[model samples]
Target chain A: TNVDASSSNCIFHWKNSSDWIKLNVGGQLFYTSRTTLTNSDPDSMLARMFSTSSNLHPGCIDSNGAFLIDRDPRYFSPLLNYLRSGSLILDPDINPKGVLEEAYFFNIQSCIPLLEPLTIPRDEAPLS
Target chain B: TNVDASSSNCIFHWKNSSDWIKLNVGGQLFYTSRTTLTNSDPDSMLARMFSTSSNLHPGCIDSNGAFLIDRDPRYFSPLLNYLRSGSLILDPDINPKGVLEEAYFFNIQSCIPLLEPLTIPRDEAPLS
Candidate 1:
């Protein structure tokens, strides 16, 4: 579909054609597409929040109207990235435990396997 | 981030955690993540329609409350796939022209470069 600026019926042709959503995760602000959230998991909390047929409304919103999620934002990027792509690319500096927690909160089951390998079992930890 | 089912403050812990969104495009049904649509392009129409901050409401809806879009559904899958991944994986049987037209209608500028190579200019057609 070539860009049709003159297509009267086309939504993209409208003057205000931006659907970018802002998320206030914890105290940080992040921008993303609704598709990314819904595609993460059909059973995930994020998916249901955006579902039009669902009776549940967003629990909170910031002054800017971004969805308010009271969770640590530090680990959200990887989760979002995982949703965009089917794989998780870990950040070496980030603690896998934290990300795993966030993934679980979001009910991103696919992310669990990817994070499992990075988690060191307590019994396996060397004396420290 | 761990899936804490008992966490009272966590939204994902709610019994109804699914946030999946349904979209009706050109009479066909498509399921996707909000992130995919917004991530495709901040300036695109799909992004704006899903943006909570935007004043424009969705134009149409099916009985199920799926946002209705008037356009050819045939080319939507590829566009959606491209949004999920940053690349367009074309189907051999699908016409690039139709996909290009749809891409233009959605204002998916990033898809244009990926599709341009597939479109054979009229001048390049061999005598037939």
Candidate 2:
């Protein structure tokens, strides 16, 4: 979704259409929709970046015309998938610990619960 | 998510732990957990495949140890992602038409709503 620059009252306009919003995560080029990123979590960094009132990164496009983040790309797909759908489908090959790190970095709490089941051991011993 | 083969009463026990269930879609090897597939939609092919009483394809693992399906692998990732998360964040580069086809094949109704906005053009004409 592109921001309407000419409209004085358009509160939620991106610099360009979300299709052009490319992300550089750990040197890997990724593209995503603004609605998908902002709708991920209201308290997330992405939400704040795309918020109408927030001046954090009005136009998150970087020097190379991509939103840059110094984070592991291995777990990004799951994280973005979670944002888009509201559920987390982690790759079996990727360690949950690494994905959790990215979740915390991005403030995606919904995923923490799913990952916790995998990371934390259940108390199988019956208490006396 | 392993099916308790020993327990004659465990209706939902998968033939094996869901983590080991591999899906081979269109000659491409793809892995997925049973929960993700079955939970996608109670009316989907996967739900029937993993249904407790349905004898359709119990223990979906094929001779090669992977669940086989002849479909487009390119859009399968997004379909699996949608199933896991209950939302669809299709790749911007991937045509919505292809993904919609997969969604229909898999019986993911939730995604159809999201994709409809993209596929069906909004009638901008005012009521005459």
Q: In order, what DockQ does each candidate have?
A: 0.02, 0.02
Candidate 2 lDDT by residue in tens digits, A46-73: 7777666656774445677777788887
List model 2 lDDT by residue over B16-66, tens digit each: 443345775643577766677776578877777765654454322233566
Clashes of each: 38, 5
Highest-scoring model, lDDT: 1
DockQ of 1: 0.02
* Collision pairs in model 2: A1-A18, A3-A13, A3-A14, B3-B13, B3-B14
How is the predicted docking of candidate 2 categorized under the CAPRI scheme? incorrect
For model 2 chain B, give the 10-residue run with minimal summed lDDT. Answer: B54-63
